[model samples]
Target: MLPTNSCSSPTMSSPELKKVTVSLPKRLDRSSERWHHYLTIDLIWYVLGYTLFHPWTSWILVLCLRAQYTKYHAPEMKIAMAWAMLMSAIGIFHIFSERLAFGSPREVDLSDEVIVITGGVDGLGGLLAETYGMRNANVAVLDTKRVDDEEAEEKGVLYYQCDVSDAKQVEAVAAEIVEDLGPPTILINNAGIAHTKSILDTTAEEVEQTFRTNTLSHFTTLRIFLPYMLREGRGTIVTVSSVLGHLGAANLSAYSASKAALLALHHSLRAELAQNPAAQEIKTILVTPGQMSTKMFVGVTTPSNFLAPVISPAEIAKSLIRMIEKGDSGELAVPLYAQYIQILGALPVGMQAIIRRWSGVDTAIAKAGLVKKDTSEKQ
Candidate 1:
C-alpha cells in the first residue's frame, strides 16, 4: 500500500504503470548512421522562431551594432533595424490574428473538470487519460479494449468497455460516466481505425466500419456530451484528425476519407457553437497530427526523416493537454509541413504531382505491405 503522506504515489511513485509512463515515449527509429538524423525541419523552425523571428531577439542585432559604434545610416545598422521591425510586425500580427480567430481563452481547472476520452486504452488517447488520472483528476476512458478492475484502480482511471462507433453504446456509457464522475467537462474524440486498402479493393462493410469509428463517433459523442457542457457553462472539446486527411493516400483511401470528413465536421461544430450563447465558454481544439510512432503506423516509413519525421504519441498528447488547460480554441498541426498542407491545392497540377511523388505518401503503405488484413486502430 502507498504511504498516507506519500505525495507522488500516482505519478512519480507508480513506476510500474505499464501502458503510460511519466517520461515521453521513446522514438522507435534511431537506426540512422548520420549525426543529423534527429535534426528535422520542425526543430530548425523552432530554433529560428526563438532566435531570429522573435521580436526581442531580432532587436539584439541593433544593440550589438550600437555597441560597435556603428552609425544608424550604415548598411549593417539599417539592415538590422529593418529586420527588427519586420520581426516585431510579425509578432504583433500573430497575437492579433489569434485573438480575432479564437477570441480570448477561457479559464480551465483540470481537477474540477470531468474528462472523458474515447479510445483511451492506448496510444495518444491513453497518454491523455492516464496523465490526468495520475494527477487524481476524474478521468473516464471509453474503448473496445477491456481493462480489469485491478488495472483500472492502479491507473486511477475508470475504464468503460464500449464500442464508440455505436451511438446507443456511447449514450449508455455517457450515463455511467455522469454517475461515476461529474458531467464530463472535457471530451476528447480521439478514437479511430484504419483499413489500409485501395478504393476498389476495400469492401463496403470495411468502409462503413472505418467511418463509424473514425468519423461518425465524433458526431455521437458531441450529440451526447456537448449538451452537458452547455449546461455546465464551460467545457472543452478536442477533435483528433490526421495530416493525411488533406492529402489522400493511395492504399489508405477509407482512412483518409474518414478523417477528411472530420475537418468539415469540426468547422460545422464551431459554427453551431458560435450561434449558442450558452456555449460562449466552450473551447474547441482541432489536432491534425502527422504520422505518429504508434501501433497504427508500425510498418510505415517516412520518405524523408529530415522533412517528415515520425512524431511520438506523447509529444502530441503534451501539446493537446497544454492547449486544453490554457483553454485555447485553435488547430494544432504538428511538424512544419502539416500546417501548410493546404498550399498543395493551390499549386499547379504538374507541380503538385512532382511534390507528391517526391514525398512518397502514396507508396509508403504499399511498400510497408499494409494489405486489407492489416487493419490498425488509433486509440
Candidate 2:
C-alpha cells in the first residue's frame, strides 16, 4: 500500500493515456450526418420550453400585437397578454417551490472535497469516480473487484477492496479512508446487482443477497459516514436508483423491490437532515435513470428508441457531477418516461394494470433471455 500522504496527491490518467491512444468505439454516432433522426420527444420539449413555454418569449407576442394597432381588449392581444401572465406566474411559483423544498445551495470546492464512491470499478459508478479523479479530487473507490496498484496510481483513484453490504467491512474502510485521504465529504452510493429470476424461481438466499447488496448497503454506509458530515457541516450524498423501482417488473422483482426501498430511504434521510441544524448544508441527490447502456442490462432492447431512448453511462455521469458541484438537493430522472413513471401510480387500478400490460414490463426480462441465478453466479 502507498503512504497515506500519497493518497491526496494530484490526479493522474490511465497508463494507456501516455503509451497508446485509441479511437472511440462506434456507438450512437451523433455525427452520423443525418437530420430526421434528431427529431425526438425530448428535443420537442426542449424547444417548447425556450420558445413557447418561456414567459418572456410569450410577452413578446403581446408587444407585437399592440404594434399592429390592436386595441387592449382585442381578442388576440388579450389572449397573448393572458398567456404571458400565466407563464410568468408558473415560473415564479417554481422558483419558490424549489427554495422551500431544498433550501439554498451549499458552496462546493472540488480541491477540498474527498469523494468516496462504492462500486466504482465499473458501470455508472466507475464513470463518476473517473470523472472526479480526472478533476484532481481526492477520490476513494470501494468495490469487490481488485485493481492493480499501478492501475490505481495511473487513474489517481485509491481502491479499497470492501463489500459495502457488510457493515463491519464498511466501518473498517471508513477508518482507513480517514487516515489516507481525510474525511470523505462526498458519497455516491451507486453499487448494485441484478438477478433476473421469477419470484417463484428465486430462492431465499438469492433474495437475501440481492437485498443486502442493493438495499442494506445504503443503511450501512449512512450509519458509518453520516457522523463525518454532521461534524464537518457540509457534504453531498447521491443515491443511484432505477426507474424500475417505481414500476416493479416480473422477473426483476427482487431487484426492483430493493431499489424501491431506496426511494423511501432517500426521503427519510433528507427529512432527518432537514431537522438537524448541523446537517443543513448536507445535500442529497437522487438519480433514477432508465434502461442504461451498461453491462448490467446490456442486451435489453428499448421498446421505443425515440420515446424511451437508451442512455449512456457518460450522460448520467455528466448530470450527476453538475448537480453535486452545484451543491443542490434534487431528484434526477433521466429520459422523459422515467420522469413521469410516478404518475402511473396515481392512475386508477384498472388503468394501471392495462398500462403495465401494454408496456410489457413484466415479460421483458424473460423475453430478453434472463434466468435465475445459479450457485456459480452468486457473486
Candidate 3:
C-alpha cells in the first residue's frame, strides 16, 4: 500500500537548488613558455591598434597637454594636437569611406531568408551551415559527400549531394534548394580544391580539375543562384579565397592561380551589381584567410607564427557569419598578414624574392610533405 500523504515525498529545498552547479571547462592559462613562443608580429600589431594607434588615445594626449595650460604655439602642445587631429581625421575618413563604398546595410531576417552553403560537408562550410541551422534558419548544404539523413536532421541542415563545379548539377541542386527552402537569400560560394604539385610536375588534368572546382564553381553557383537574388531584390554572396592568391607560391602554383581568379571574380561581381538597380541591397563578401589550421594544410609550417599565424576555421566561420548577419558588403582578410600581402607585389622583384624565401614560401609545401594527391574540397 502506497502512502497517501504528500509529506512522504521529498520536497525540493533552496539549498538543494543552490548546490547545483553548471560546470564549465577551466579557462586556458597561457602564461607558459609555449604560449609566449606562440606570440608574434600580428599580436603586437593588434595590441598597438588598441593602444598607441588608437584615435581616442591620441586625443587624450592633446587633452592632457591643454590641461597643463600649454600654449598652442608650444612644440609639445602643437605636436600633440597635430597627432590627435591626424588620428581623428583618419578615423572619421575611414568611417565615411566604408559607408560610401558599401552603402547602407540591408535588413537580414534569418527566419525569412534561405541560406545556401556549398562544400558544407566538412571544415569551415560545415560550421557555418550548423550555426545557421541551429538558429532555425532555412539552410541548404551542397556537397559531394553523402551525409546520413539522421545526421542532417540532427544538425538541422538540408544536405544535397551535388558537385558544384558541374553546371548541370548546380542547376539541379538550385531547383531542389528553391523547392525545399524557398529562394536562397544568402549564398556562400565556398566550394574549392587544391593541387599541391609544382608547375612542372602538375598534370594537365589536375590543373583543369583544380580550376574547375576552385574557380569555375563560383561562376556556376552565381549563375544559378544570382537570378533568384535579383528577383528577390536582396542577397549576400560570400567568396572564400586564400592569401596565397595575392602571393603566388612555388609548389602551389595552380592552387594559388585558382584563388587569384576569385579575387577578380569578386571585383567583377561587385562591378556588375553596382550597375543594376535591383542589386542595391545585394551584398558581397570576400574572405581571404591565410593558412587556416585545417587538414588542407595539416603539416605545412608557417615561417613565423606571430607574423603569419595559422588561423582556425572557427575564427573564419565567426567572421563570415558576422558579415552575413550584418547584411553588409566587405572584404575579410584574416591573420593580419593577408591584408598586406598585396604590398609584396609592388616591391622590387629581388626584395620580393628575398621576403618570399625568408618566409619559407617556396619550401613550405615540400618541407611538410604536403603534396597530397587527394582531390578533396579546398578551403
Candidate 4:
C-alpha cells in the first residue's frame, strides 16, 4: 500500500520551463561567395553521371525509341543502342578495375575496433574523431592540443596530449591507450603542418620540423602501434596526404615534398603488409584532398572554383568513414582535378606550361600574400 500526501490537492503550482538556447559555431557559406558558386564543374559532372551518362538512363532512351515504333536500323535507334552498350561496358570495367586494384573488402565491426587518430583535436581529424565518438566506438586521439574534461565528456572521446612526431611520446601514449581502451586497430596519420615559404627562404630547421610532423609522424605511430595490430591479426591505416604532393606549387616546397614522401611510403607499407601472412587483413587507405577549407590554408584561394572548388573537411571525413566502415582499402583523390593531376605531368611540356600559367598554381600563394618571409635581416 502506498500513502498519498494530504496537502497535495490543497494548492499545486506548476513550475515554468525555460527554453535553453544552444549556440553553434558559424561555418563558412561557400554558396553565397560568388554568382557562379551554384554552377561548379563538379555539380555538372555529378548530374551527368547520374542521368545522361548512367547506363540505365542510356538504355531508357533505347526503350523510348522502341516504344515509338522506330525501326531498329534507324540512325537514332542505332545511336541510342550503341551509347547504352558503351555506358554498360564502361560500368563493368570500373567494377572490375576496383576489384583488381583493392581486392575484396574485409568485415568491419566498429564495436570490436579501437581507433587512434593523430591531430584529432581540430580540422579533418577532429571531424572524424567526433563522428566515431558519436557512434560510441573506442577512439583515442593523440595531439599536442589538450581537450578539457567537459568537452571530452560531451564528445565521448579520450584526448591524449602528445606530439606524434616523437617516437617515445607515441610509444607512451600507445601503452596508455592499450590500458585505457584496448589495442588500437585503426591508425589515422593525419597530423600535418605547412609553411608557405619558398625553398630558398625556408630554413633547414623548418624543413626538418615539417618532415617530422607531416611525414615522420606516420612512421613513428606505425612503428609503435602497428605491432599491436599485427598481434591482433587485423588493422587499417589511413594516410592523409595532399594532392599538392603530385603538383609542386611555389612557396609550398617543404609541404609538397613531405606529402610526396608519404605517397611513396604508402606504397611501401602496402607492399610490406602484402608480404606478411598475418597482415593480409591489414588494409590501407590513402587520401589526397585539394585545398581543404581549414585554418591551415585560410587565405589561400582556389585558382578555378568551377574546376577545383575547395573541399570541406566534413566531406572528406564522410568519405573516409564510409571506406573504413566498408573495410575497403583504396586511394581517394577529391575534386575532379585531383583524380587527373597525374595526367598533367605526362602532358606535353608546352601544354603543361600553358595549363600551369592559366591555373595559376605557382602564383596563388604569392598573390594571396600567404608567402612567409625569411627571418634573416639584410646586412
Each model's lDDT: 0.91, 0.89, 0.88, 0.91
Query: Looking at model 1, which ten-residue stretch has the lowest summed lDDT?
Result: 370-379
Global CA lDDT computed for model 4? 0.91
Q: Judged by lDDT against the true structure, how good is candidate 3? A: 0.88
Winner on lDDT (2 vs 3): 2
Across 1-379, the per-residue lDDT of candidate 1 in tens digits comes to: 7757736645455557467656544655556567788899999999999998899998998999999999999999999999999999989999999988888899988779999999999899999988988999999999999999998999899999999999999999999999988899999999999888877777788899999999999999999999999999999999999998899999899999999999999999999999999999999999999989899978888889999999999888888999999999999999789999999999999999999999989998888887665345422
For model 3, residues 188-284, the per-residue Cα lDDT tens digits are 9888777778776787888999999899999999988999999999999999999888888888999999999999999999999999999999999
Give candidate 2's error at residue 130 in angstroms. 1.1
Report lDDT (Cα) of residue 156, candidate 3.
95
**Local error of candidate 2 at 105, Å?**
1.0
Error of 4 at 201 (Å): 2.4
Clashing pairs for model 3 are 40-306, 192-378
> Candidate 4's residue-wise lDDT over 1-379, tens digit each?
8997666443577665799997665664344566777578878998999999999999999999999999999999999999999999999999899888777788889999999999999999999999999999999999999899999999999999999888898888899999999999999999999889988889888899899999999999989889999999989999999998998899999999999999999999999998898997888999999988899888778877888898899989988999999999998888888888999989999999999899888998898788989978422
The TM-score of predicted model 2 comes to 0.86
The TM-score, computed over Cα atoms with residue i paired to residue i, of candidate 1 is 0.88
C-alpha root-mean-square deviation, each candidate: 9.2, 10.8, 5.7, 4.7
Q: Rank the candidates by TM-score, best first.
A: 4, 1, 2, 3
Error of 4 at 186 (Å): 1.4
